[model samples]
Target: MRVALGVSYNGQSYDGWQSQPSGRTVQDQLEKALGKFADQRISTLCAGRTDAGVHGLMQVVHFDTSAERAPYAWVRGTNSFLPRDIAVQWAHVVPDEFHCRASALSRRYAYSLLESPVRPSVDAGRVGWVFQPLDLAAMQAAATRLLGEHDFTSFRASACQALSPVKNLLRIEISRRGAYWRFEFEANAFLHHMIRNIMGCLIVIGQGKQAPEWIDEVLAARSRDAAAPTFSPDGLYFLGPRYDARWGLPDRTPAYDWLP
Candidate 1:
């Protein structure tokens, strides 16, 4: 049987979503816990691979397992062996044709930023920090240039293995509340470090270091060197993927409410 799981984790402790020889990645820990629960080795494929220090509010993953157990059993059992920072939020039996990654229509991500003169203390690993005040209008204007389909090579990372540099960015919402800033992004797919690179540019524009139209110049350049440096991943969160309703997968986990 094929099973789908909605997992949530505080990524501060793990290297990333993928497995590594160091055995300190989210995937490695998850698989190990699953193996202990199922009494056999199991593998998983996630909807998206988050980078180091990137949290996940609802990370979907699917794996084929012969172990016949109730959905709740899988959740509780696997989580019993996992660390406190990671937990399997929900589980459901899925059709063999359902692929966690391939079935996603679009992926969503959010970055929480703290705007303050002093560095973050309470939420140090949970948010990015910017000492200088930011202009909301300026950042929004700069973000507008990134909407729609375009070659995002300027924002793509050098080690990105994506087949193409073109991606359709569906939305970019920037909102501020008190000293907190939230930037949300939805896209058909993302290249490695794409959002972080864009965040660097937007923050620059927000601080008056560059004009809003500079985003256009960076896009036209199609060179990574033309864009600003990649921002910190501390605030990045994988909001999960959008799948067809026919799949009957849960759109979100309860952890969504906990995010700022």
Candidate 2:
């Protein structure tokens, strides 16, 4: 039987979401806990792979296992062996055809920024910091140009392994509350470093370093060189994927309430 899991983690202690030789990734830790609980080795495939220093509020993964246990048992059992920062939030038995990545209709990400003169101490790794006040009007204008399908090569990392540079960016929502700002993105898919790279450009434009029209020019260039440097990963969070209602999977976890 195939099992789906909703996971959340503070990525500061791990390398990233993917497993590596270092065995310091979120996947590595999750597999280890799952294996221990099942008393057998287990492997998983995730909906998306987040970079180092990026958190995950609701990362979905699926794995096949013969071990018989209740759905809630999978969550409570696996989490017992996991670290404090990482957890299995939910578990469900899924159809054989349900794949965490391939079945995903879209993926969501959120970046939190703290616009303050005082540098972050408590929320250092949880937010991107900017001393200069940002222009909301300019940032909104720039972000509007990024919506819809386009060739996002300018915002992709050089090491990106995606088959195509084109992607459908479904939404880019920007909101602010006091000194905090949140940038929420939903896309059919994303290339490596795409959101971070776009964040860099938006920050530049918001700070008046470039005009909003500059985003259009950058998109037309389709060259990474034409865009600003990739922004910090500290503020990035993988909000998980959206699937059809037929899957009966929870679209959110309690962590969603804690975030902007």
* TM-score of each candidate structure, all chains considered together: 0.99, 0.99
Per-residue alpha-carbon lDDT of model 2 for 90-160, expressed as tens digits?
99999999999999999999999999999988998999989998999999999999999999999999999
lDDT of 1 at 202: 96
Regions of model 1 farther than 4 Å from truth? none
RMSD of each: 0.7, 0.6
Q: Give, for candidate 2, the lowest lDDT window spanning 10 residues.
A: 251-260
| Model 2 lDDT at residue 25 | 99
Residue-level lDDT tens digits of model 1 in 108-149: 999999999999999999999999999999999999889999
Q: Model 2 misses residue 248 by how many Å?
A: 0.2
Judged by lDDT against the true structure, how good is candidate 2?
A: 0.96
Which clashing pairs does model 2 show?
none
Q: Which whole-number lDDT from 0 to 100 does residue 194 have in model 2?
A: 99
CA lDDT of each prediction against the hidden true structure: 0.96, 0.96
